[model samples]
Target: MELEEIFNEYILKSEQLIITKRSMNDIAQNEIKNLNQKKEKEQDITGNKNSTHSMDFFFIQDVKSGETTRYKNIRSTVDEKIKQIVLQKNKQYQWILSESFEIFREFLIKSYAYLGYKDKNIWPLKDYGSIILSEIENKDYSFFLEQTKTKRDVPESILNIFRNTFPEYKKLETCNKLDVNLNLEINLIEHFRHIIVHCGGKTDEKHKLIEKIIKKSGLWNNGKYDSKHYDFISSFFRLKESNDIILLEIESNNQDGFPNKYYDVLSDLMNSLNSVAYLIVNEIKTIVK
Candidate 1:
C-alpha cells in the first residue's frame, strides 16, 4: 500500500481497538457499580438485625449456609469478571502495540522497496533481520546472511539504516532521536506485551516491571511519604489532574497494587504510538521527495 494508505489503515484499526477497549472498560465499571449498589441494598436490609424467634437448628444452619453461599457467589462472580476484563484489556493492549509496530515495520519495508530495493534478501535491515531470525525456524548463519545481504558483514541498526540510507534529510537525525526516546518510553508496554504473550501476564517479570515503574514514580522516598511524587505518578499513570498536575491514588486490592484502570494506561500508550508514528511517517515522506 501507499504510505498514506498504510497510515490511514493503521489509524482506522487503532481507533477501533481503542473504542473496543473503552467499551470493555465501561462494561466492567458499570458491573462493579451495580454490584456495589446491590451490596449496599443487601446490607441496608440485613445490617444490625436480629431474629425475633429461635428457629430449628437444621433450618437455621441451612439458612445461614444459603446466605453465605449467596454472598460468596456474588463476590466470586465479581472477582472473576474483573479478572476476565483485565486479561482481555491486557490482551487488546498487547495486540495494539504489536500491530502498530508491525505496521510501522511494513511501512519501512515498503519505503525501501519503493526506493528500488526490491530484493527480499536485501530488504530486512540487520537489526530487524536478527529479530526475524530469532522467531523463525531457520537458525543457520547462511539464512541470516541471505536475509541481510545488503549489509551482511557490517549490519546497521535501524536508526543507522535510516540515517545512512537517507542522509539528504537532515531532520532524520532529530527524528531518529525521537524514535529512540519513544522506544524507551514504550519499553514498559513492550515488556507487558512480552509477558502477556509468553507468560500469561502473570510472570515475575511483570511484577518487577510494575515495581520499577512504581519506584520511578517517586511515590515512596526512603520509607517516607512524599506528596511531591503525586504529579509524577499521575502523569505517568495518566490519572486525573489536580491543580493542572496529574495525580494518581494508590488503591489497595487493585491490579498490581496500582489503579485498576489500565485502560487509561493503554490509551496513553496508543496516543504516544500514534503521535510518534505520525511524526516518523511524515519525516520519511519529506525524505522521499
Candidate 2:
C-alpha cells in the first residue's frame, strides 16, 4: 500500500483505540464517584461512617495445587479503593503510551524501506560505517538493517537513519502545542518505555544505555538536573540520583501528577508519531513523483 494510505489507516486505528480507552475511563470514574456517593448516603442514614460493611473483597488461588487462599479480606474505605483503581489506570496509560511508541517505530521502519525501494540512494551514508543490510521478505528494497535492531531502540538513532537517507531531511519542527524540545522529549519517552517494559517500571542502574540516555536527554546533565528538565520531564517522570545511578520515579497514584489528566505522555507520543510519519510520507511522495 502507499505510504499515505498506511498513515491514514494508522491515524484511524489510533484514534479509535484512544476513544475507546477514554470512554471506558469515563465510565469507570463515574461508577466510582457514584459508588462513593452511595456509600456516603448509606453512612449518613446509618450513622456509621467507619463502616466496611459494603466494601470490596477477593481471594487468591494457587494454580499449582488448586488451593484457594482467603487473602486478607481487603476491607477498605471508598477512597482507598479509588486509589487502587487510579494506580491500575495509570499502569494502563503507561502501557498505552509505550505501545504507541513501538507502533510508531514500526511505521518508521516501513517508511524507510518504502523510500529505499523507491530510490536505493535512500540507503545509509558512507559514514554510517558498514551496516549489515538484509532484504525484507516480499519487499523489493526494504533493507532490514542496523538502526531497527532491538539494542538500538534509541529515538535519535532511528531519526538519524532518516537524516542520513534523505539529503534534505531536517530536524522535526518544535511541537508548538506542547512547547517542549521534541528531540529530547522523544528520547525521554523511549527511555521511560524501556524502564516500564524491561525493568518493571523501575530504572536499571546497571544499564549503560540508560545512563547515556539520561545524560543526553537532559534528564541528568553534568551531574545534576538540566535547567529545562522540568519543562518536559515533569510531565511523565520524577527524577532522582541514588549512589550515582539515575532513578526514575513514576508519579502514578497522585491525581495532580500528570497535570494534563494523565494524557501528557500519550499526547507526546501521538505528536512524535504524527510528526515523524508525516514527514517521511511527504518526503517519499515527493521522491516517487
Candidate 3:
C-alpha cells in the first residue's frame, strides 16, 4: 500500500478507538474546530482578561456555596501548552497503535497456519495498510465499542482528555526523570495492562488499585482491564489470607518462586506508594474545583 494509505488507516483506527469515550470525543471535536495549525499556539491571556469567554466556556461551580468561578478563564499560556501537548500525545499514540497492530497481525497470520496456509500466501501479516482502511458505517467499525455492549472506555480516555482540555497537564516536564510523577504513573499503568493481558487474571493490591481506579471513574468498564497478570501481582505481593492488612510487596520481581514467564515486576522493593493514584488525583481536583 502507499505511504498515505498506511498513515491514513492508522489515523482512522486511532480515531475509532479514541471515540469510545464521549469526553475525549468531545474534546477532539472542539479542538479541531478551534485550531487550524497543529503546532502549539502562542497564548494571549490579555485578550480574554475580562473573563467573558472563559466564564462562558468552562463550568466550574462550587456545589455547596452556590457559587461559580470568579475568574473568566485560566491563563492563555496554559491553554496553548495544552494544545501542544495534546498534539504531541496524538503523534505518540499513532506509534503505539502501529506497533501493537504488528503484533496483532502476527497472531492473525498464525490463525491462517491453522488452516494449512503456507508462508507465501500468509506473508507474515505485515500489511495493516489497506485492510484497516476499507471502511463501512462509522458506528459499526468501532473495535472495542462493538465488542463490549454494556460499558464504555472513560478512564483510559480521561488522562488524554485532561491533557487536551487542561493546559497544566499538557505542560509536563519532559526527560526530567526525577520530578516526573506522571511518567512514573504511566509506567505503572503499562505494566498493569501488560500483566493483565499477558498473564491470567490475577492481582494483588496494586493491581486492585488499578482496577478500582478504572471502575470508580467508569473508564474502560467493559472488563478488559481485569487481566491475568493481576494474578501474578496478587500471588507475589498481596496476602491471600489476610483481609485487612495492606502491605507493599518486594520491589524486585526477581523472586525465586515466581513462575518463569515473559514479564517481570518492580525494580527493587515493591514499595507501596501508600496511596491510590486515581484517588490522589481526585482529591486534588476536589480542592481546586
CA lDDT scores, all candidates in order: 0.47, 0.59, 0.36
Ranking by TM-score: 2, 1, 3
Segments of candidate 3 deviating more than 4 angstroms: 1-154, 172-178, 197-289
The lDDT of model 3 is 0.36
> What lDDT tens digits, residue by residue, belong to model 2 across residues 95-184?
666777777766766665556556655555542245534433234432333433432544566577666655455444343444545556
**Candidate 1 versus the native: TM-score?**
0.51
TM-score of decoy 3: 0.21
Better by lDDT, candidate 2 or 1 = 2
Greater-TM-score candidate between 2 and 3: 2
List the candidate 2 regions with Cα displacement exceeding 4 Å: 48-50, 53-71, 125-155, 165-169, 174-178, 204-214, 218-226, 238-265
Stronger candidate by lDDT (2 vs 3): 2
lDDT of candidate 3 over 1-289, digit per residue (tens) = 2223333454454345434333443565466455433322323534432222222245678989989875555544334555554544433333343333333222222222221111122222232223343431222313322222222342333334334434544444122223434334443444444544444223445556556544543333477754443343344334454322121223456667766332212211111111222222333243233
lDDT of 1 at 173: 32
Greater TM-score among 1 and 2 belongs to 2
Error of 1 at 289 (Å): 2.9
Query: What is the overall TM-score of model 2 with all chains considered together?
Result: 0.71
